[model samples]
Target: MDVRLGHGGSMFFVRDALRKLTLLSLLFGMAFRAAALVPENVVVLYNSSDPESEEIAQYYRQARGIPEGNLVGLALSQKPQISRDEYNRTIRDPLRKIYEDRQWWELGKNQSGQTLPFVNRRPVLAIIRGVPLKIGGSPLPADFKSDPDDPISKRNEAAVDSELLLLGGLDAPIQGVAPNFYFEGEKRFEDSKLSFMLLISRIDAATVATCKRMIRDAIQIEKTGLWGRAYIDYSNRHQMGTSWLNSIQNECRAQGFATVADRFNQSFPRNYPLSDAALYYGWYDSSVSGPFLNPQFRLRPGSVAIHIHSYSAAQLRDASRNWSAPLLEKGAAATVGNVNEPFLQLTHRLDILNDRLMRGWTWAEASCAALPVSSWQSVALGDPLYRPFHHLDGSGEEIERDRDFRSLVKLARKNSDPGQRLKAIETLAAKQKSGILSEAAGLEALAQGKRGEAQKWFKAALVEYQSADNQIRQYLHLAAIARHAKQTKNAAGILKSGLSRAQSFPNSAALAEWLQIVEPKPKPKPKATSGS
Candidate 1:
């Protein structure tokens, strides 16, 4: 089945719609309380061996208003990777001692009688850039045998950020992943029984400047709200992964976020023009590729872009390698990656991550809640306290400014019948001359096999769209419908027209490439045949 139609699968019934409305009301009615993450609850760790690390820590403290005493610097290796012994000796043990000395956590014992920190005072830890990124080369204890059934469980390699989550329980075996106590907990992090487990995130990137920008961007964008399109690339390789991306697509649309979902085996090609990308979730790419390769490509400020791969966060200082740092370099304020080969199931579940963020959870809260296990490979990067959707909890002017989006959200929530929803959206689009609504209606039409209606809505959207990139996107949609119908000439004509209109846009080059794909230049006529 076509991905477009697949995504637009049957809508909920009236009962489901009412239930969803009740859920939304409850979510919005709950105010952010003291249980929410605060600056006072964060302990900033920096590499005392590196001046830059200290500088970043201080900078973040000032930006987020964390208390100066909360900042702790540790003398440690500046390399991106460190030995597990070095991690335990330099990073883990010393930090634990500090927590103990300050009485940040109350010591207790688990069922195994291993002493650990059970009650927490400060529960969030922000690791600075200069700290080592991951641990390597740590052999298991001599008496410990490898798990025969789970080969991957024997690997002791892990991300330093992930390892810190277990700072309270260092005596526990670190050979296998530990089940996260807060994986899907309904209570807030501070309110949950596992509040002792630290919520750790890294404030590191390829460069100090980028790290500072990430910190500042998160603080600034949270004021107005992060608004724009969501680009979801669904690599239809496995059912589990595909379902996750599919849920993300539905959630984005239901929330009134303009979304583009690609259902191709490979990531979007380099020439694909992706604009206004405030949220990105994709997978299976080893390194950064596609539109991100274009120097002009940049995510909107405070964007949360994530690409799932085994080694996507293998290192943080090199933007040319892996997905996380490159995404940070390209203006994403937050992202998630794995420092080692975290099996597919162990990696961040993007659907859950997106849903949590949308519900106004902090970056750290959302990241941890989405993961099934910790003490493994995942690393949450960016300001741990960032709540990108906090504005959604209020009836602020920012929400009023994007009235079309609000209307669409209402349309989605109030109408469960797919046909009725599309019709109502079309009516609203016409009434308000909203390109966002027109485009959404067009997508819904295409999903229902209404090609002619889709074309009409796309044309209307092309006229109403304000941004050149959005207009170009409408043209591409129209051309795709024509091509699918075997109207090659019509597709070529649409592309040519779009190419002309896009000349002044930054995405013009990408649009031109699309034109070439739809209508390649004819081969030169064979040289005059040799004279007979």
Candidate 2:
């Protein structure tokens, strides 16, 4: 009787243990599913190298309904100085500036006497780089003059200190702008573009990285810098109307800085564009603190800051005088009251932000001059689907991959003719040797929110034909363009249309890839609504 009782008790304990294990398994499965849905935020660094950047930003912004504040703009000076080969050592000349008689900072500190609540609200930071050469009409401070033998050692110290402050080394992102490009213009030179290239060549990647870090760390907001990267440099001035001006308005609006757009267009009363730069204009005459606050519409002539990108002397004078420049263009001069002059003028300035500005001469520049280093970047706008590298690996395989992609990219970029670019891509598609499969998937992902499935298909396709990189690249370009219109099905169709040709000539090496993207059964579909 005792042995039977013991056996029955042991069986009961075993049954209880199994039930607990099942419950634990169910809980863990739920947690894993939840983890998969975790969302992430992406901050795009952009500047107007092409129209697509802004359009891409806007399309995403509107499509996703991200708050205006989420899509921010960063400021940079893009002035050309000189062009040099990649290997040649280059020297960056020191920019000089001396404001006469006017204590601009003091006036700015206490201007309008009304209010600057907004300025205090937002953070300000600075970024400084390059070796210092001199300081204010005197020897540099003694504290930093490590080289006693150098005659200008004292001068260099003060300059160094100023540069450090400008770079916001202390992490106080209160105000950061390049004194050279911010106050003056780019230096006058024989060939502006060539000069700019030379200057940029002198700037080491370390200095750029330092500046980028400063900007990112200084912003008080949770999000770091989301400024367009293209406009960050002082050499690409032509990209402005599309990148700079419009970004000013968009970022200002997003940051809760402005009420009226006119405040941005109007020139300040006393020729002070720098001091009066603000985020927004108030109900009557008040302005908020941010990028759009222009003390004077035009900057001082021949100054290092504006020298890179200032309008003509006559244009500057007109802007400084009282915002009286002819707002009309040759095509629209006939339309009088019908045309809103301030808006039109502002739009002209803002037009720099639009990619369409690159339509005529720019199309060629973008097509031919632009260089893509690898297969992933070979597409005109640079789709990273072809090459599987964010940074080059420098391996033998990587070198070969890089060279092959580079050739294809050069092939695409070498032609300014749109028809030729298409023809080249189509010809490769017929052979199916190498191409961009991920790009097609990216488009598909954008269209139907079936990102995983699209990714699977792209990976599978690439696995099937890594050798034919060109065909893959063309399909990727098509995907980027289609993402704007919310045509997921059409994007998918592009893949299907070219799939047969893409697979014909496959890579003998590389493994077969498999993936399927699916949404949660789409909530079992709703019942149909019928007419009553």
* TM-score of every model versus the real structure: 0.85, 0.22
Q: Which regions of candidate 1 fall more than 4 Å away from where they truly are? A: 1-36, 110-114, 140-149, 397-403, 410-421, 447-450, 482-493, 503-506, 512-532
lDDT of 2 at 139: 32
**Model 1 over residues 17-36: C-alpha lDDT tens digits?**
22433332222122212234
For model 1, how big is the CA root-mean-square deviation?
Answer: 8.1
Candidate 2 residue-wise lDDT, 65-171, digit = tens: 34444333322222221121100122111111101121101111113232111111101111122221112132323354243332211221122212321221111
lDDT of 1: 0.78
lDDT of model 2, residue 370: 23
Question: Which pairs of residues collide in candidate 1?
Answer: none
Alpha carbon lDDT of each predicted model: 0.78, 0.23
RMSD of each: 8.1, 30.5
